[model samples]
Target: MRKFRKDNLVVEIYENRIEMGNSAAEDIADKIKELLAQKDEVRMIFAAAPSQDDMTSNLVKISGIDWNRVIAFHMDEYIGLPRDAEQRFGNYLKKRIFELLPFKEIHYIDNGESDPERICTDYLKKLNEASIDIICMGIGENGHIAFNDPPVADFNDSKLVKIVKLDDVCRQQQVNDGCFKSIEEVPKEAITLTIPVFKRAHNLFCVVPGITKAKAVKRTLEGKISTECPATIIREHHSAKLFLDQDSASLLK
Candidate 1:
């Protein structure tokens, strides 16, 4: 593994899946334990995607982490999807993590059956009131972070959450991940946590795997800091780390 710092952010790149997942999960559990040692309650943000499967699974199995004292928040949700919908990101988290563990509170972006702007406003208000201790995320094959795809990504964006149209690359990635049967089946719009909100977390753990992510991973790590490759802006944060399996880090120098 290779470790470095860009500003205040700490980035770590690992060689393969087993090591990457194990180390990332331990690091996350350790951070959570540290926060609980300091206070009664801790807040966190989670990303829902296949890239996070190993880390999330390992995280729930770690003992003495006080799952009940954590308040969980999610990163994004597809607009207009029902809570019960198979494609719902909220439902994904509920099944994969939240339902298995107890949390003091779990706040999800309710993009179903509400005016998009109003939902964003309400979610933003909730975020502003809570100070997030840790955030777990993944880098997209398109170099997108959260739902912040290229054309729409805004580094200086001030909104906490907003509706965004899915770009072609982002849509195809969903198809590739088996989240949808095809690009046509994927939702066109989503409500996403803005870059500013992601940057606010005290610690960020970015887990990226698969050979398909190799090119984007290389760009995010080696390219100029810009909205084009949204995840590249991690360089701007002080406490972010990137965990990559060999497949994803293959293209890196």
Candidate 2:
């Protein structure tokens, strides 16, 4: 692994996605162990995506995490997918990791709620109820963190959770990632945890892989800190670390 710092962001580049995932899982496992030693429970937010496959799989296989004492929350969910829809971020994580573990509790955004306002209010309450310790995330091909795409991202958003319209680039990414068969199949709206909500977490880990992300990764490191490229904010975060594979880091200077 090649490790370096860009401002306050820690960057670790690996030979392949597998290696990057393994290293990220190891760092997260070690951090969880350390946090568990000091507290009775640890609250963590997880990002659901093909990008996180290697990391979450490796994390679940690590033996010492004591999943029984950990609380899991996902960062965002599509606005209208059915409760059990495979594309729903919550259900996506459920099939891949949550069901495999014994978490203290898992909180999911009720995007199925008829009144979107109520869902956002309830989720915000739960989030503000405690301090979030760890966040495992990914940068979208469009440089979005979670679903905070450029058009809707706000660094000082007052509401922790809110609904936002998905941008064309963001919608196309779902198809590119194979989450949807085409852009039309993708939801045009989503209920996302605003950028401010993500900032509440104490430690953040962004794992990005593949050449598709090479441009976004490069912009994150070199662009101005603006919502034009929301991922750029990661560079200003004191406890944020970005893990990248050679392909994803190919465009980085």
Candidate 3:
């Protein structure tokens, strides 16, 4: 367990799942309160993954959170999947967060039987109009951030959102998470927000849990800034923090 401080942001790691979740929720609630006190609206981006389950659930339970003044955005979605599909990222967010809150609006990538390019363009426009107050995300076992797999990650990518091919590791991860029945059932492609968009957030809270993520977490935290480990870029962001339970941080020296 360690804390990393960059400018006004503080990232604290915990050795316990319950402690990590509780601390992250409290931090998020504090940030929301601070934002609401100074602005009429607050925009946030959320990652939909099993690792975020506890954090999102606790966040929704926070009292005095002005959900009516909040606009929520999701990180990425598999291409060619229906929004209502069991494997859809949209369904995950709806079941875990949006349905549990009174958010003013929730924007998600429209990967539901639409033209891929058109969906990307629409989401790019929506992100441009939003002033993201916080972005909550998790690191993949492959060290990928969002769908920006190691092979395709670009720190200076001009496109806010793009279609990306899922690497083998990433596809297998979805299967392991039970989002799909098997590796072959996972989509090969997805539309994801680029690194620049993630870095554009006023604050970033990265939650990583489980032994499966230990290697990736260690590399990302103690690695050189490069596309090979996309999450390493978080270390460069002035307002980014990483939260990890003991299992995820186990490999860190």
TM-score leader: 2
Please list all clashing residue pairs in model 3, or write none if there are none. Answer: none
- Model 3 lDDT per residue over 28-92, tens place: 88999999999999999999999998788889888998899999999899886666786788888
Residue pairs clashing, model 2: none
lDDT of 2 by residue, 197-233 (tens): 6676889999999999999999999888899999998
- Model 3's lDDT to the true fold? 0.87
Question: Candidate 1's residue-wise lDDT over 51-135, tens digit each?
Answer: 9988998888899999889999999988756668877888999889989999989998884546888888888888888688999
The true-versus-predicted C-alpha distance at residue 90 of model 2, in Å, is 0.6
Error of 1 at 215 (Å): 0.7
Off by over 4 Å in 3: 4-11, 111-113
Candidates' C-alpha lDDT: 0.87, 0.91, 0.87
TM-score between model 1 and native: 0.95
Global Cα RMSD, each model: 1.5, 1.0, 1.7
Q: What is the lDDT of residue 121 in candidate 3?
A: 91
